[model samples]
Target chain A: MSSIISLKHLYKEYQLGDGSVFTALRDINLDIHEGEFSAIVGPSGSGKSTLMHMIGLLDKPSRGEIIINSRDVSTIDDNQTSTLRNSYVGFVFQQFNLLNKLTVQENILLPATYSRRNLDFDPIARSEMLMEKFGIISKKDSYPNRISGGQQQRVAVARALIMKPQLILADEPTGNLDHKTGNEIIDLFEELNKSEGITLIMVTHERELAERTRRQIRVLDGEVISDKKK
Target chain B: MKLQGVSTLFTSSFADFKRDKVRTALTSLGIMIGVLSVVLLIALGLGLKNYIQNQFESLGANLVMILPGSGFSGGRGPAGLAGGAEFDEKDVRSVEKVPNIKYVVPVYIHSSVITTADKEISGSIMGANEEIFSLINIDVQTGELWKKTDVEKKAKVAVLGNTLAQDLYGNPSDALGKTIRVGGMRIKVIGIANKIGNQERDGAAFIPYTTTFGSMNPKKTFFAIYLGIADKESVTTVKSEVEKTLLKRYDKDRFSVTEQSEILSTVDQIFGILNIFLVAIGSISLMVGGIGIMNIMYATVTERTREVGIRRALGATTRDILLQFLTESTMLSLFGGIVGLIVAWIIVLIVRNWFPVALNLFAVILAIGVSSGIGIFFGVFPAKKAADLSPMEAIRYE
Candidate 1:
């Protein structure tokens, strides 16, 4: 399969208030191929979230090259990087970061609204289809705060797919939901990756969830300790 | 950005305002008051100008007057120069000869006491010829005007003003044809001019120039000269020609010629300055309004930091964030401007009966423009702050 994302010697660092540097990711190298359903498993503060941030183009690595959709975008300007994020990458947060100000439908259509790239399909129609598929069509007019955690996450997932992004990155997408709802969300992710051939990259601490993916990469202290196919 | 995108952004921004009703109204209040003061003050100034213009128009349109003692010096005259160096018959005769000059009447003015049968009163006495009444277009209310033969004959006849006639005798008709003592001369009343509200004629009496100089006071000279031009448009030409003739006959330092147009323009200049000063005061309030918006927008930026992060993650460029916040603030101030206009209209309607209050379309447009401009000007710093936020950190903010 063709590679959708490739990272080379990536490093991330932060400066503390006392003028000392702390490394978050050290010389990390990895590749994610198209249509791959993968999971990065690690304990809290193990740099899994940092790696997701780097891959999502929401951040810049201190020293690294990142190729997204076969194009180098490690040092792109803020506008170009945002455009790439909008057109190529979609992210689901652990907190189900649906804007409370927007209704469910509006929240689902948020990505398409800010995208500079012309959408091939109508956003309203696409949002409707996704809401129907996710069983949240009845709550389409409700705000994020009014819906249940599972419903809000479903809206967020629909939002992530609005622009038909090539890659979906979830940083603990089911962390805030109950077990049943979490499994349901995983099933939705599995269906997307299997039926639609969309690449999926999820970060999780749950061993069972990580095992459910087709491939698992275990991170320990900002380094990949294991990579295994199911 | 595309039109649809901008429209969506505006809808979101407007929804935010709707969610915080009281805060939005309070934020817009500054702009409302600013625009209110501007519209009302400008309306008042224009109204006053219109009222004064109407008053000037009521007085004959073709009238021109001459003041004594130097046009350049404002007629204050040199120190120790008595009032004797005023306009005389020579100037009046020369003015009459100028083209477009229809009539010229020399006026000899003085304050005097008149003792009639049963009452004595203090009043002004104007010594002028028969042409003087027609020059000012004062209509005769009762009795006939003095004839030219009466002026040349130096007959001691008088024409009382409406109020003066009423004061002297209980009725205007009672004063006519009766002999009354004025300035120590027993003058018979010939006529009474129509009552034209409070004016020079309303409180004074008219006597022949021949009568004043020939009988009452031989030492009196013409106080001023009034020239009646045949047409109002010919005033400028007559003024210049009158000036040249008077300047050649009497030194330029001795007299000043003033057309009706000059006085009107001087009034216009004063009103113009006044309007500018009032508008500046109004602009200060508008500027304060703008600053108020800036302060609130700064607070809003702090409150919506997470939202900024969310929008950034959703593919909003820094420029989009900037424009969205900017549009919100602009709509805020523009809303205030519209409210201000409505308030000013209500106020004008309430107060219009007591005072002249004209609505100027230009001021309305300027108020709207100024409010919108203030929105953009003040909204920038906070919008920039929001746009410059780091997306990762913002999304991570609780």
Candidate 2:
């Protein structure tokens, strides 16, 4: 299968207020293929989030080439970068990040509202289907604050999948959920990966959740220590 | 962005505004106060101008005043007054020869004490021809005006104004046929003029012009000449003709003619300037209100930094975010502007019951335009600041 994301020699650096430079990621080289269900496991501040941001086109690498869906990200401007992100990437954050003011349906339809490309299908009909699949249809009119953490995360996941992007990037998706709820979310991600053949890249510190993915790339001190394929 | 997308942004913005009712109401109040003041000021100015014009119209149509010397000259009143050009019987005769001339009533005015059986009061005694009654639309409330024979015969008959008669005899109707002593002469009051609301006409007494000039004081010249034209449209023609006739005998700088339209226009011009000055004062408050909106919107941008990142991450372009915020602040100011208009309208309604203020649609529209302009203008800086935020940094903001 063709690779969906190719990161070649990606490096990210931050400038401290004291004028010292701190490198977040160095000489990172990795490829995430289509239909690959993978988890990036690492300790805190090990550059797992930085790598995820770079892969999602949420931030630029300090020095490197990032090719996503066969297009080099460096050549694209901010507007085109946003278009690329909207067209091919979906993100699930640890905080769920649903706007508190928006109801579940409005939050789920947010991606479609922001997409510049013309959508072929009705976003509302698809949102209804996704809510049914996620078992949260009854809470569709409720705001994010009124729902439980698990329901909010499910709504966030539904939002990420609303545009049917080529790849989904989840950062600590189960960090705030109970163990049983986290396992249930993991099961949903596995089902989506197996049924739709959607590429899934998740960042997590939970070793047990990382073990359930088809592959695990463990990062330690900004370097991938092991890449194990199940 | 598509219309649908813009509408969605507006929907969210409105929901966001509704979430904090107190802040929104207070923010809108700033703009409301500014708009209300501007609208009311303009309305009052226009209303006052209209009221004064109507009063001028009530004096008489087709009436013109010929003043001695230039109007710009100091220490001179209207015609025949001291310290300027002297206009007497010859000037009146010359003005009578002008085409479309109806009645040339030369007034010999004097201030004196009049005594009746019951009281004594100081008042102006005007000596004019019988045409003065019709020229100034003065109706007789009791008895009749003096005849042309009464003026030409130099009769010592008098007409008392409504207020003057009331002051002298305590009743306008009872004052008829009663003799009032002025300048040591006992004159019988032949008529009482209707209430015309002018201090000169409503509170003074009138005597025959020939009697005052020929019998009372043959040396006293006429003070002013009032010309009643045959047709309202012929006023300008008659005025120029009278000026030309006078210029033939005297210098061009010796006299000036003022039509009712000229007076009305000068009054209108003064009120127009006043309207502009008042509106400018009101706009300063509007500008402050705009700045207040800007200050609050800037704070809103800072407060919503995390929200901006979340939207950007959800695929909102920089343009999208910019337009969203611009729409939000513009709507905020527009909301205030509309509320201000409503409040202004209510105030105007209340004021109309007490004063003669005409509501001006143009001024109202201009107020709305200014408010919207302020919103868009002041909102740009803060909206730009919000749009320029880095999405990655924003999303990470706590």
Candidate 3:
């Protein structure tokens, strides 16, 4: 399979109040292929989340490169990076991050609303289809808070897929859900990966959650410890 | 950003205002008061200006006046209250002899308590020649004006204004043939003038200028000379001749020859300055309103930090976040401005009977423009703060 994203000697650093540099990720090389269901797993502060940020193009690395479609994200300006994110990346946060003001339909349409360019497909049609598949079509008019936690996560997933992005970045997507609900979310991702050739990247601290995915990349203390394809 | 995106953003921002209705009103209230005071004050100023303009227009425009001292240079001469060249009978006669000058009416003015048997009013009395009535468009409502023979004989006959006649005798016609004291001299009221809606003329009593020499003006010098031009085309020729005649008697610095339109334009210039001054005073409140918007926007930006991060992560550019907050604040101020304008318009309409208050187009434009400008000016800093937020940290924030 063709690689959708590739990283070369990636590094991330932060400056503390004492003027000392804090290295969040160091000397990392990785690639995520299309139609693959993968997980970047580690304990908290293992730089697993930081690595996700770099891959998502939500941040700029202090050193090394991130390549998507042969373009270096580090070399681009913030606005260009934004355009890249809009066209290529989709993100799901642990908290769901659904705006309280909009209805579920509007929340699902949020990504398409902020797109600087017109999308290839009709956003309403795609959103309706996604909602139908997720079985939350009846709750389309309700607010995110008015619905159950699992439904809110479903709406968030619908939002992430609205742009038909090259990859979906789920950051601790099941961290807030119960075990049963979390398993359902993972099953949904697996189905999309299998049935529609969608690339899925899940970030989690739990090893069991990581093992459930087709590929697992383990990280500890700003370094990758292992990469395994089951 | 695309127009569709902007519209959606506006909808989102407007929805934010609905969550905290009380705060929204309170935030816009500052701008409301600012626009309110500005429009109201300007209305009052315009009303007064209109009143003055109507008064001047009522008098025929084919006229000129010679004042002592350089009049209407935006500064009064050292003539001290009754300042300027004290034009007398000789100056009047010389100006009257100038070609195209129809009639030269000399005037002597004084303030006095005019009294009847049971009533007295502090009033201004104007003493002029018999031709003054026609020259100044003073139409009589009752009885007849004094003939030219009365002024030659220095007759103790006075014409009362409609309001003044009403005040002393309770009816304008009741004032005719009654004797009222002008200063210390008793004069018989010969006529009651038409109600002209001009404050100065409506309140003053008119009499023969010759009669005032002994009691009202011991110096025997006329206050001003009013010249009615025979033809409109000869006004300029007559004006220069009158100026030359006056300059021969007194220094040019001590006297001025002014046409009717020049006087009107000078009044317009004075009102322009007055309007600017009033607007400056109003701007202080508008600025305060802007600052209020800014303060609210800063709080909004801080509160929405996580929201901003989410939008950015969803591919919203920094420009989008900045524009969203700016549009919201501008909408707040514009709302305030429109509300304030409506209130001011209602007030102007109510007071229009007594005062000629006008809610003009310039005021409307200024209200909308100033409110919008204030919103943008004050909203910049807070929007910058929001745009500069790091998405990862903001989303991770508790």
Candidate 4:
């Protein structure tokens, strides 16, 4: 399989209040293949969230070469970084982060609205299809506050997939849901990865959830401790 | 940006306003009051100025009153009477020599009663020289004016105003040759002056100064002088020559010369002061309204933090965020200003109907400019606050 995202010798550091430096990610190199369902698993303070943020293009690494579809994004400015994120990346935050004021359909259409490329797909039809596929079609017009947590997460996932991005970065997408809902969300991600041929990168502390993916990487205290094919 | 897009922003703003109707109404009320105060105050000032100007016009155009005083300073008493010195027939003769002096009339005034065979009306008798008719531009409606020959001979001929003629004789035409007793002396009605409405002259009766001084009060001195300049451009030269002539006649600082230019300038000064006073009051109200706008904008920024975050995350530049808030503020203010202008115009119409004032367009334009400026000035800080929000922090904000 062709690699959709490649990171070489990535390093991310943060300045502590006392002037010391804390390394969040060090000497990390990884390749995310097309149509792969992968997870970065770690304990608390293990830099798993930081790695997810860097991969999502939501944060810049201190030193790294990140090539997504042959574009070197690490050297790009903020505007260009946003453009790259809009064109090639999708993010599903742990807390859902659905805009409370927007309806479920509006939330789902947000990514498409922000993306650099204009998709000619009908928003209403696409929102209805995603909602119907996720078994939340009845909540399409409802506000985020009116929907359940699992439904809101489904809406976020729908929003993430709206732009048909090359890579889907999920930072603990199911962390806030119950076991059944978490399993259902993971199943949905797997289904999307297999059928749509889109890459999936998830972060989680749950071993069972991380074990479900085809590839798993474990981080400990800002360092990748292990990488294995499940 | 596209018109459709701008309209969409407006629609969303209105929707948000609708969601919080009470707050929106309260904010709009603040702006409304501010704009209303500004518009109404300026309108009122303009209306008063127009009324005063019209009153002066009715008095006559380029009409200057030169009273006997010391050196153009003490001519008239505090009540516009001939006080310190007396301007007599000789001064009138001298003033006529000045170029552009269209007519100079010396007046001797007295309060008296006029009586016919059947009726009597009491009013002021204006004893004026023959030139008074031309100086005041009085139109004769009946019979001939008291001629210069009549003034030199002191002919007992009177020109009754329309009202006085109606009072003394039921038919003004019949009174043309009829005799009336004024101040116990009989005088023939030679002419009936045209009616000039319910002004000071409406109740007056004119007679030749020669006849008045020689027949009724021969020992009394002349009271005041009135001069008519040909046009506005000639007023300054005529006034200067009249002043120099008067100063040569009277003691220094004893006589006062007042011109239309001086009176108009005084009126302008009064109006200017009134404008400043009213604008200050309006500005205070506008500031209060601006504060309300600021508070509302701040609340909007807080409430829409997540939306701001979403836009920022979606590649919205800071300037775009700033422009959005500014557009909202400007829209609010512009609508408020328009409403204020309409209300002011309506009120001006009502005032014009009920009073003697007219609305000036300058006031209207000034109100709009100031109100819109207030809106933008007050909107900037809030817009900046909204634009400066960090995407990460705003996204995390509840």
Best by lDDT: 3
TM-scores for all candidates?
Answer: 0.81, 0.84, 0.92, 0.76
Residue runs of model 4 more than 4 Å from their true location after superposition: A111-142, A147-150, A175-183, B1-5, B61-90, B96-102, B106-224, B230-241, B251-277, B354-372
TM-score of candidate 4 versus the correct structure, residues matched by position: 0.76
Clashing pairs in 3: B68-B84, B68-B85, B69-B85, B69-B254, B79-B83
Q: Model 1 chain A, poorest ten-residue lDDT window?
A: A111-120
Give me the overall lDDT of model 2. 0.86
Give me the overall lDDT of model 1: 0.85
Q: Which stretches of candidate 1 lie over 4 Å from their true place?
A: B1-3, B58-60, B68-99, B105-224, B231-237, B244-255
lDDT per residue for candidate 4 within B1-398, as digits (tens), equals: 01124554566566566667787667766777887787788778767776676555555678787765432232333534434566677887888888897778888888887788877878778888887877666778989888888888888888888777876776767778898888768988889888876444656788888777655667645677788888988887887888898778676555566775566677778888998898788878878887888888888899898778766665555665787787777777766777777877787788777665445676667667766776688889999998888765676577
**Per-residue lDDT for A128-175 in model 2, tens only?**
999999999999899999999999999999999988999999999999
Q: Each candidate's iRMS in angstroms? A: 2.3, 2.3, 2.3, 4.4
- Candidates' chain A TM-scores: 0.97, 0.97, 0.98, 0.95
Ranking by TM-score: 3, 2, 1, 4
Q: Model 4's lDDT to the true fold?
A: 0.77
Q: Candidate 4 at A73: error in angstroms? A: 3.2
**Candidate 3, superposed: residue stretches over 4 Å from native:** B1-3, B73-76, B79-85, B169-179, B184-186, B247-253
lDDT of 2 by residue, B232-318 (tens): 889879988887887877676667777877778778888889989989998888988999889889999999998899888888888
Q: By descending DockQ, how would the candidates be arranged?
A: 3, 2, 1, 4
